[model samples]
Target chain A: MMVPVRCFTCGNVVGEHWEEFDERSNEGDEDPEAVLDELGVDRYCCRRMLVSHTDLVDVVSPYQ
Target chain B: MSEEYDVEFVEREDREARFLVRGVTPAFANGIRRAMVADVPTMAIDTVRFIENSSVMFDEQIALRLGLVPLTTPPEGEFVEDDTVTLSIDVEGPDTAYSGDLVSNDELVQPADENVPIIDLKDGQRLEAEADAVIERGKNHAKHQGGVGVGYRHLQRVEVVDDLPEFEEQESQIVRGVIEEDGELVSTTEFDHDLSKRYPGKEVRLEDVPNAFVFHVETDGSFTIEELVTRAADTIEARATELEDAVQL
Candidate 1:
């Protein structure tokens, strides 16, 4: 997964929430904003880190 | 006799807090800030050994991710520097790996926030690793930093001159202060640095109190902000006492 360790702007640790956020958003049970709010992520910088991540591990791992 | 110093709470919350300190020297104020940013110690993953890997995330990447996870710092006197806390992760593919998966050998030093995502595995992928946690100061690295946003500002007093032109049209664009009765601009009760930038040439003047400071602290869940501040104060006191003892010696 292409999870960032920290928010670029605020430097708050954010990579930990990517899995649950992805699962809930994909299941259509909740939107990204609601999921982030529930997770106690209140900053826009940290929120953007989750909403913009893409899992490129599958493609990159094959070359390794 | 030492001058009396007063601490007033401006705001308080679980992860963040702000307070005002009055009748203190600038050196003392900055000492607290330095102690908070560099002296206070926290638990962080210092080393990682991969046992198995079939996932796409590289070993180094996985290690880096694990190292950044904030581990709970035990209460005062409970932390031993260089002591090892082990964490192991074992997971199969077709799912996601999280900080919750990394179980700690010591219950007191587990991940502060459990829901952090470490990696995502496809149907056939798997990852296993063992991580060692160590107590370190923020001076050694940011990962060991107890507080994320530890800073302070001089308390400000703002006054608006009424002789200036009233730019009612630009009122909405003001970054700080609010329009009040008689079309006068009044500084907001909150201390904000952007007050002067609200209007380019407006008659708002701000004066900073030399001996009064407003401190703002935000923690990363490894420890309470209050605990961090208290510990920082203790660290400063210890250092000062050491200096005095050396002078006597």
Candidate 2:
């Protein structure tokens, strides 16, 4: 349920950048585009990995 | 006789690089690409044993995630292929278990990116695991692939043919990879991959440079770009030698 370790399309490691992307995009007002760009995540496939990830780990962990 | 090859780096970085190689056939160029993708060896979690599992996620799921986490591969001779490195993690509830938390027995081999989230433990849930990372070739499993993205294209040579017809709307001509103009290498990105933009109001002829190829390689942090490339070249050489010896015998 956690962020995937690699992009579904390109297999690039995007999990490592998830925490910073979430923190900056949610806490600060920085644009997600700029944040992804700054993180050197250029491919649309890799970008989708961060934008579309739903951290269901917290949601599912409470059940079991 | 050995053929002399010329190599020029179009762009170089820690994890990725683009280089132009001359004096090689398309098949030889493809061989280099294939070797980089499938022959290079790197460390990846091969077997994971769970000491405790109170989290919601299944042990298998957690193991898959751990296997995907890129680990820093030490230099050759430090560990041979199939050598195993031990790493264990223990995290209690009210917190998350990140890759950084994995305690590795080998200092030289650790997680390349620390922030990779393995799982999130709730208030009382716990996750403990001991994994054996084995050095293996990408041919065995994709998780061991050091070169995540490896590809090449023929080097294009652009020649200005003549001026475009007056008042003619110039259609967008897209050209990717690197191009050679006036004996200088230029990446297509420099002109936004649009040939019309680089040569305005003019017709241009694009031709492939015989025996020249441009390769773009990106690694998964298991190793440096230089190491990935050189190791790939070494693999090819070794294979060629083996073939020669077999034919003689």
Candidate 3:
């Protein structure tokens, strides 16, 4: 229901950088690629973890 | 075999570093790499007790998330394997719970990063829990791995051999790891890992510098690079001493 604490593939801690990534890329006008680059997320696997996360907790939590 | 071992840092940062270790056999280098990855202990949530949960996710799922959140590990001798630090979190609905919300009883063992989201609470939903983080080695659980990425390679030197023959097709010669050229160390990535790009229309010979290795290590923020390396080395030394004592008996 949240961004995983680590990248599923490489186990790098991507969760620590999620709020910055989201705020800069989604909420602000920065490109996702630039944001990830600035965050030092070099590997494609770790990049995908941040790019593809949906943050479904809000969608699913209402049902409970 | 009396050569003294030497170490030099190529790149150093809080969580990641690259360094050259000279006068070590391949086996010794590998031992250091393995020790860094699996021997050094870090604190991770090992037990969780929920006070209330109206969120959609199951308790087990949230617990797993909490377990993976990297916690700041105190220096060696501050904690033993079974020692646990208590942390608790409570958040009301219309808000998202994050690692920062987890209040630690021990200040030194707090979460490494505050932005790691644990869960999102919808309107009226709540998440409250207390977790016990225990010191453990990576061999016990992946969550306890402080050195998330630990690896090394033999230091290679590139020597110019000869110019390419007239009209000879120049093929891409890709090399990985750090390379020494003219008494200077350069990462292969500086030239895109292509020998051709570095020395166009020229032949180059690659030679491994005996007993030298370049190690690249990245941690999970639980500990600094210096602490991780020193702790890993200490672990190896301790094990060797234990073996020696056993043999003497």
Candidate number achieving the greatest DockQ relative to the actual structure: 2
TM-score order of candidates, top first:
2, 3, 1
Could you give the candidate ranking by lDDT, starting with the highest?
3, 2, 1
Q: How close is candidate 1 to the true structure, as a TM-score?
A: 0.79
Q: Compose the digit string of candidate 1's lDDT tens values, residues B45-129.
A: 9899988987777799888888888888998888679788899999898887888888888879888877777887887788998
State the TM-score for model 3.
Answer: 0.94
Question: For model 2, what is the alpha-carbon lDDT of residue B136?
Answer: 93
Error (Å) of candidate 2 at residue B235 is: 1.5
- Alpha-carbon runs more than 4 Å astray in model 1: A8-10, A17-52, A61-64, B160-204
Per-residue accuracy of model 1 over A1-64 as CA lDDT, tens digit each: 5788777665578877777888898556787888999987778888988888887877776665
Q: Taking the candidates in order, what DockQ does each have?
A: 0.46, 0.75, 0.72
Model 3 residue B241 CA deviation (Å) reads 1.4
Across residues B7-71, which tens digit of lDDT does each residue of candidate 3 receive?
99999988889999999989889988888888999999999999998887899999999999999
Which lDDT tens digits does candidate 2 get at residues B171-241? Answer: 88999999998899999999999999999999999999999999999999988988998899998988989
DockQ of 3: 0.72
DockQ of 2: 0.75
